[model samples]
Target: MGEVRLYMFQTGTLKCKYHDIYLNQGEGRDWEIPVPFYVVDHPRGLIVIDGGTPVECATDPHGHWGATADFFVPVLDEKDGCVAQMQAAGLDTSRVTHVVLSHLHLDHVGAVGRFPGARHVVQRTEMDYARSPDWFQVGAYIQSDINRAGVDWFFLEDSWGDFYDLLGDGTITLIRSPGHTVGHQSILVKTAHQNVLLAVDAADTLDHWEEKALPGALHSAVDAVRSVRKLRAVQENTGALVVAGHDPEQWAAMKRAPAYY
Candidate 1:
């Protein structure tokens, strides 16, 4: 199989509590962590894992994200947006064939509007949860960002069980890892050299993996624990390199776009 290259992009950074991310007990220092999105250059077509915060959030922070924007206060320049990052890496954003949304959280799916031509993949449960009036996390889901035109939205059924092979080629696999949100998922990319698990909020840091700790912000602690266990099992089975969602230290050390893994 031809290797599918994975490129990392930082759409922006937002300030959140360390305790909220890692389930750590403390006063919780403010964490300015990278909001990451990935591009998979597969042989079939380009796939974007998560969109990160859109440039709109930068321009009209309060307008797009409401009070949460003010609370987290995303630090982003216009150039730090997903489209700019893809262009910077010399990839055409319009050519992005498919967009796999891990969940509909503001931080993850903010750039969903940027790829209008792409078919967006999300779990059925997540779409339902996003559209609901329930205020679970407060400012977690923004309807305007998701309910829009030109989005060829595709939802995976609950019957898919634990995982759905996105391409059916072993290039990109979506693992059903819930708890952070109702239908949260993670991506596993198989390259020629190694398998990489984009544990995208499933485990926010190595600490979560090491300690098997549920995130402080969780929908169901039981499901969170099960998701973590799934990640561990995948790691043990395939020896995949784990990339956490909001790990400050890990983000600092990763090779950013213009470089690929």
Candidate 2:
């Protein structure tokens, strides 16, 4: 079996609904959420999870994100992108063989075009949901990110279990945990010492996961709870370290890119 080293990168940050919003109903505070993308140095090839906010979003946030841009306001810089971050970490962008997205939301797929050589993976149901999203969810789905030409896409349409082993080695697995989005998923990486669950939007913060609370942003509350529970079970069963998608606390404690897990 191949050992894996996972590195975390900060692509950007998002100012979004505060924790109180999900816990209560008052005019909640604003939370600054860190937007992270992970690079897995797998024995077979380099793999990246979730592209962060594009550099272009910094110049024209409204144009790229529309109305919701004000809600989860992105803080991006020119050098904040998948390729740029990888390059900064001393990795060759051209060597990225797989790019797996937990979902197709703008923030999660913004820099998808950066990895030209990688097969961009997503759930088929997510693509379909993005194409014909409900009125309320329209602001989160950007067509440009999904319809780019020349970008290779590998859709996970069918799987035997709750997850699909991307490389068939059990080293990396994509688990179906729909909640934040209809087809939202999470990544499970088996390292030498422990299992790491990249619970993307399935659980935005550790607080949400620990409390079994739903975030302000979600497609289905019922499904969202179910998804978080699944992740919790995985963590409990495997004694894995669960990584939240935008948890400031967790991000603060993490070792930045170049220093890996």
- Top-lDDT structure, candidate number: 1
lDDT for model 1 comes to 0.84
Q: List candidate 2 segments past 4 Å from native.
A: 1-3, 19-26, 158-160
- CA lDDT, every prediction? 0.84, 0.83
The stretch of ten residues in a row with the least summed lDDT in candidate 1 is: 22-31
Deviation from native of the Cα of residue 55 in model 1, angstroms: 1.0
For residues 1-261, write the lDDT of model 1, one tens digit per residue.
Answer: 456789989987888776778675557677678899999988777898877987887788899888887667788888888888888889877778998999988888855867767889999999998888377565888788788777899999999787888888777889899988899999889876678999998888777777656677788888878898898899889889999988889889998888888
Prediction 2 TM-score vs. true = 0.93
In the predicted model 2, the residue pairs found to clash are none
The list of candidate 1 runs beyond 4 A from truth reads none
- How many residue pairs clash in all the candidates, one count each? 0, 0
